[model samples]
Target: MTRQHVLRFYVALIAALTLGVLGVGVVGVTYLSSQTLIRNLFPAALLIAVSWYGSQRRVLVSESDIWLMGTVGYIATLVLLPFPLAVLAVAASKGLAEATLLAKKQRHSWKGVTVNAGGTILGVAVGGGVFASLNGVSYLWSHQLDSVFALPLLLVMILLYNVTNELVVVGAITLTSQENPWSVFWRLSRAALIPEISLALVGIVFAVLYHSSPIMAAFIVVPVMFSLRAFESVATLRRETVEAVLRMAEHLDFRDTSTYEHSQRLADLTRRLASALELTPEHVEEIVLASRVHDLGKIGISNEILLKQGPLSEEEGDIMRKHPVIGAEILDSYSMFKSSVSIVRHHHERWDGKGYPEGLSGDHIPLGARIIAVADSFDAMTADRPYRKGLSVDDAVERLKAGMGTQYDPKLCAIFIQILMEEGIYAPSEAVPGELHLIAGGRASGGRAS
Candidate 1:
């Protein structure tokens, strides 16, 4: 079963166990107590059961009105009897009801299984613990049946039970959902535990001061439930934004054959080079992103020229060169892409001021752009093209080193070669001529002057 299903099962089992235990405890206490104690304990147990059911419903609906109504009903019933049994009965009832509702709802909407299961488990544990503690305290205080430590011990037990429930629910959700356990734990805790625990703490402090006021304690559960809803909404939005960006990248890949693995390889190479050069994580991410989208302007190029097997004529070459400009323009139009425009536009620029478009040389080029230039060249040479076989990794490193200070920055070239060596790409039979083979090697083969 899915994580949600397992969570639901656990919540239901806890609820059932709580009710069963409470019922048996109340029955045995009634059998052993005087008539007055039995009368008092039975009503208190009923009240606790009802409260448990109401709290469970509140968890699923997550509506303040339902929770308030449930709490009010529990209080009204408890006040009418002012008996420990009545309170226990109400709490257990609420727990059972909430667990059932969660199971039913999860059956319909399985996508929210993790959230549902987590909330349900936590809700039941919290509600059950509160009910049990209140019952224990009332019996101890009213009947003088226990020591001063009894109520405090019960409270600790309740807290431990709630914590265990949270862990189990979080674990089941992670396993079933195939999500990282830590991530699931954090997310569920932020959505459920943080708010609930905050309110519970307030209630605990209030109870310590007032001496077991169930009515007052019930008031804090409302806002905690609301906080859970808010956290879930935020998490959902963040997930959607991430998915949207990935989809956009996928769409871009569909437009060009060369783009299929280009961005990924470029990103990898750029990250390696960035690390070799001792750049920080922030700088590495920027360089990697820039490398991935460096040729984004090529989207504007016609398929006719993009897929051409032979060398382009002068006019076509000129048009092809305009892609960087087109890419820069496109990036400049988006506020989010502004920083990447330089890399897209200047990746073609050489170190000696002989590159295309702006012909920016040396330090004039943006560092990110220069890094992308090296990565893009490396990837392009090693990747197979329609008219050319992919160069070996060794030859590619050799070409990168051969072009240092002429077409590429010498320092960057050194780092790039170091990265290749470190990544085991510089081994014999794997190396290729890289950018030098694509540019200089081509010119040399044709007997053309540089």
Candidate 2:
């Protein structure tokens, strides 16, 4: 079956199970005292409203994951209300948010809202039920657990709730999106994990004070929300700035003939290589950002030169060579992109001091720029251009090997060739010692001229 069909089936099954659970909770309200119900209902409703607001002001964490504060709302509710009540409150919050979205003329997707709510409620049900089974509803409804001093159990209970919540949420997200649930978990679990622990601690502290003064408990939420907003602004600015860089790169293909994806492929490979080299995540990310706009200077070159079917004239070549400096100058204006500016300016530099712009040699060139230079050269050879046909994979590898000491970093080029051979991008049979030696130096770079 198609992926959409698969998702629909899962959604239907989840909806049925969720509805049944909520139905059972509704039927068992007789077991809850009116006083108990009255005490829990307002906090539940208030948290629901708060969660809906958070959902509206969510932050994107990845292409797949988002940082929504709804879990913060649910965690607070789960610690103070019964398991059934927690589920109902969380679900009600989602339902209410959808209504608000509709009122505002936004697309309140049923799949987006329902699956997420259902998964969250399911997780709370599992966690809280386990907590109640072990200690009854004492912690759920009283201040006793607050002073228990049994830190381990309290932390364990909090962890159980958060972990269950994460698994369910990820599953729902996986079903709705193209990303693998496990991969998404591994990638973002850390980002969300720390925040979840901090928020859970906040909830536990708030729950303790809640019994003393509901108004004070209410007051705590305002600062927390504002703090999150402040943090969100910084994170959002970074993401939006990266997006703007990508949008600027799209200008490379003004008439729809530019090899825009060439930059994308180079960026992907450059990041991969940086990671393979065991570079820090920060350096890898900087390399990625630089690769995205490495060709930005091409925008300043006239279309006549860019679209030329033959070799560039000396003047045209001169204009083409200025792209790296132009790109670096443009990026230098943005202080936030300082990490990438050097890489853009020096991506054309050579290990043997024959490269353009500054002609920086060897390790004198930034590692990020060296990585991009290799990636850029490989992509240029492999990609079909108006002036030349694309080279075969073997020819590209051979050409990169030829340029290793002069045009590329010898260590990185050797490593890159090894990677290509291992991935079978180049024939494994060609990986004999004779070929290996050729990668580092023995052969003349001018042995085969284009």
Candidate 3:
């Protein structure tokens, strides 16, 4: 589908989900005391605020939320309030979150808000319905319910809530992204399961304690939640920075009809290669981001020059070689991309110290840059360009081998080739990289020395 068609379709889907949830929620609506409503605002809005902050960061693949605080709010509201009241509390919190997002101009698109609000409402409704059906409200409201039984059932309730939200959000993502539903489901099935469970238990503990010691729960537990939020804040900032860099990168690729194919393919390959080399997750994420925007400096080059099909004149070559420096400088301006700047600055540097911008050779070059160099060259060789048909993947692999020593890091290139040969593709693998040995500055591991 065209971009407009996709947007129009998702808008309708979001509206439908929203309206349906509102309709079902009406049935659950009942009068709650003013005191209960007032009390819920504290946990609900505070959680929402933290959640609002957390939402600034996005995760990969399906691009759903990772709001531990928000999840806690839903579970807490369900455990503490009646289904109808919990629904309102959840809605109120979400409404407030939307407002905050809008006021700060932090929201990227209305579609994102719609998907978030719609999926959340539906999820809460389903979770509340399940909880109420299981006599959970009775247990929660009663003063004499046994702790042992309540705790176990509360776990089930939390699971139900989490699953309901996950399904609604994941389903929407599947439909929008056109990713395989089964594959998405399997990937997300185990994603954040532990964190969800742990947060649910925390919510249960809070609710149970709130009955007798509201102050303690509010003081101790809330602070603990804030601590988690602190970490999430750092992550959010990092993600937001990377996202900005990506937007700039996309703009560089936007004018062409290929839809950023070169960068995207390179990024994907580099990620697989990084994994096979036993790089840490953070290292992998940085490498992937760097690979995607490694050529970002090309945007600064003149289109007439960049579009030239044949070999460039020495002067033109000099201009082209300036991209790494430009890209690195552009990235360096962003504090979050400091580490990535190193990779971008050095991606063109060769094993033999004969490449552009910097002539750093061998182990002196950043490992991530080495990885990107290989992936970038492979994708460039295998992807069709204006000048010529691309090479076959096998031929591309052979080309990589041909340049293995002089152009790329021998170890990283070998690991990438080994992994590719073994798996036949960069498909998801349960196999971890062989093993890793600590390298200089510990940026990239030596990985069992090949």
Candidate 4:
């Protein structure tokens, strides 16, 4: 199994075991008349709850996990003594989980995860220590300090702790991912404050309701902030990655043709097909990128072959087949483009295994490539070419229908035809005088015919 699958399985197993243990402990506590059973059960319950909650959230655990665990830890410390020391232990756990999850999600190296977790732990320690010191001072000056002063001070400390918790979590994750700490901090801070503010308000409500220490209620803020921040961070990363890929696609188009209007049209068509196929946004993006760079391998081919006046000879055709391979190689060099390379390499391949360098066919072909092939073929047939006048959209649709299950993927072909028909995309070919002359002139134009 893949690492992700294994991790998920392990998490599921742990959660199940924790629940089982908690169940057994509950029974034991009820049967046995010992306070020890109840005491021991609380810690186990806290551990199980925290771990299970963290596992289930996938992206971010509920803030309650940290609060409950911290509360239990603090209570343990307090009966032996007193004060809000439990909050610190809870905050530390929160920081550690945040850092670990971030590292895993970002695919950071082990060393990076270690450093990030360590940093988070350190930040929590410092923040918790400061709060503890202030709390001690407040206890000592109980008679001297007024309720108004003490309440405001508690609020300030809670706000500081919540802010610091967010920063530490984001910082550790970003550092582990090798992203700039400042950039991560700034990006998250800008987008995440609303959620933090909301959580802070909730903490205020809790403090008012309890009429106890504000610091105890302050624990609620940590999880709320962490959840919001983590979700926003992940969403932002996805959006940025998609935009970057789209920009790269635009670059590819600009390098080949002055007008990327055709690329835009193809992108629209691809999106429609994707929706019809019920593809996820991630899959749609992959398809779009693949379609955008469908002709990328042409860059490696000589201008003569790419701009050939007439039909390619047998030898020339052989050279043309290499374009897909070359394109795949170029895309494979970059990590971001890896998902798109297969589509680029195999868009020319036929469903029947009769196409290109590797004739492996049927389900073996990548679905993204299959979808692009139909779109590419339809676009190519309808677009003006050096050797022939562009076919009318109606004609292009007919040609695509004719080639279904032979040269193109049947399912994708049907989708493309449906899209074209639905959008009223088929129209009579528009002739350009220059383009006609260029095609008619053929070899005389030094292969500028196309």
Candidate 5:
């Protein structure tokens, strides 16, 4: 099915399930006393609303996993309110909070609102219904000694709620991206497992505190939200630092005669090839960043060597070969760039142990480095330099095929070539036989090595 059709069906299914759950909840509606309304119900709803607002102050741990506060509010709401009230409170609080916090363009469309609300409702309904059915709600609602035994049930509810909520959201992502649902689910689950469990425990704490004194719960939840926002600020600053480094790398393009925007183009290609290989989003992001700074060590090379128009002498070649090591050292100074260091340091490493600062071969080379090598060579071969005209796309493809398992990973080369062909970027008919002309030293001057 088409992506849109899949998304539509999935969203419709969530909406239907939400309506059915609400219908079941309506049949068992129990009126709250004035004291109960003032003490538990009102406090639960307000806590959820506050928590929802706090949840918006989040940090993105990965492309798919967003870590946030406010599970405390949802769990507390389920603990203190009836099944129908808990579901409605979570939906209303979250939807309203997002509406208030998010910009118009960020919301995408009203369908997003429906999916989010429906998903939360299903999560709370399923988890709360299960807890109440098992007679664990009484222990949770009252500050009783028996609450110790009910803790396990609360854990189960949190697990069910998180799993149900995550499944609903991951289902939408899978449908829209046409990705394997289990893969998407696993990535999201693994990324958020610790934080989700921790937050669920916090929610249970807040619920227990409320049973004793609502004012005490309020004091606790507020500080927790502020702590979350503080963490969000730190994450934002780190991201800005990373962006600043990327900008610096881009500026370095001006330092060379034949390598302008070379890193940028490689980064673009790396993203496509990495994603095509079904790598995780975080892995794709890391490789793309690594490709952008793969040649960062070149800053240490002399201007004459960097801008040389012909093949280098043995001595000059040795100096040029030090760049990958130099680049890795430059990045190693910064903890944020730790992940990219190996990739930058080893991008020149060959598949058959013939290339590099290190003579690592085959699977010994880091996967990110291997991916960057193919992207680097392709960009270099297709790009015009001071000494020679760039090869045609077909010629570059031919070169890549010829180098497979020697200069590049055979599997990666094959995959990259297929991607180029499918994208219509390489036209075989336009290729000329002499386009693969060798310069002195059996290498194309100012090409891949540059």
Candidate 6:
């Protein structure tokens, strides 16, 4: 389905889920008290503020994903309020905040707001229903040792809430990106699960404080806000580091346009291969990162050797091979990029043991490196170089097939070939190279050492 259709369907699904919960929630609404009703407003207003603040300083997950840090508010609502009231409060506050705060220029702003609001409503309603069913609310409202004893039930509530929220967000992302659903879900869960649990724990604290004295709960928001700011600061720092690396990669791209373009195409193909192989989100991200900077060591290569038109002489080749080690060393300084360092260093290593800095054969080489090798070889063959014309996509496939179990991991090569054929990109460059090359990073320089 088209993006709009998918979005419409998603919004419809959210509405259906929210309404389904609401039907049962109304029955539970009678459980709410006048004092509880008044208390609900505090969370609603706070959620509005949080949502507005979060929208302004969005955490970038990827082109298609944004990490929303409003879980505390939702969890607080679930803990302090019951059923329909909690769901209604979330919908009203989140909807108002998103409508006011979301950029007008963003596509599907209204529909996205609806999905966001409805998703929160469904999560709170369903989670609250489950919590109430297990008599979990007594833990938050009652005296000493209640919450301590009910820890297991509280955990279950958090899980259900997060799972519901994650499903809605993941479904939207999958629909919009047209990526594999399982991949999208895994990526979201890996990044989000810890933070969501932490926030839920904080929310429990908020609930406990509110039960003792509403004023105490109000005071806790200050520390919670500060903790969120710390999370944002760390995320910002990581983003800046990634940007710095990309800038360096762009500098390398400038040195040899072909090599840069080769990185770009190779990154794309490798990501496809990694995802196809069902690697974890973390591994997939590492492989994609390694593909982009696989030639980073080339940055250390002399201009004479780097810009050399023909195949390198044996001496030049020796210098060129050192790029992987140089690249890994450069990346090693950053803790966040450490996982990718091995992938970068080993990307050129061959399956049969003749390739690169490490002659470790087969599974001994990092799997990420193995995936990049297959993609790197394909992009190198198909990419247009100054000296020799790029091979046809068909010829590239033939080369990959021939190199199976030797130059490349046989499984990776086969999967990549299947990706090409399944996508009908037998001649990608002719149709739309820009659209086919779908990873972040800039421009073309196709050559890389085989």
> How many clashes show up per model?
54, 0, 0, 2, 2, 8
For model 3 the TM-score comes to 0.49
lDDT of 2 by residue, 277-394 (tens): 6443444676788898888877787888877888888988999899899888888876557767888999999999999899899988987888898888888889987667999988
Model 6 TM-score is 0.62
Rank the candidate models, highest TM-score first: 5, 6, 2, 3, 4, 1
Worst 10 residues of 2 by lDDT: 441-450
TM-score of 2: 0.54
lDDT of 4 at 343: 80
- For model 3, residues 1-450, the per-residue Cα lDDT tens digits are 643466468667766866776666555553556776677756655545444444443333213334445565566667766677667667767777777788889666677677777767777777667777878767655768443455556766666766666666565555554334554554455555666676566666666666566676666456545647754665677678778888988997656645487777777889887766544344467678778778888888997777777999999999989989998889889865666788898999999999878799997887788888888887788788887999887777777767767898766776676566556553223433343112111223332322
Q: Give the residue spans of candidate 5 off by over 4 A.
A: 30-41, 60-66, 101-103, 141-144, 233-260, 269-287, 293-378, 392-450
lDDT of 3: 0.67
For candidate 6, the C-alpha RMSD (Å) to the true structure equals 8.2
The top-ranked prediction according to TM-score is: 5
TM-score of each: 0.43, 0.54, 0.49, 0.46, 0.64, 0.62
Worst 10 residues of 1 by lDDT: 60-69
Off by over 4 Å in 3: 1-11, 24-27, 30-68, 141-147, 222-265, 268-450
Model 4 scores a TM of 0.46
Q: What lDDT does model 1 reach?
A: 0.57
Error of 5 at 96 (Å): 2.0
* Model 2: per-residue Cα lDDT at residue 83: 66
Model 5, 174-236: lDDT tens per residue? 655444677668756765666677777767777777767877776675657665775567567
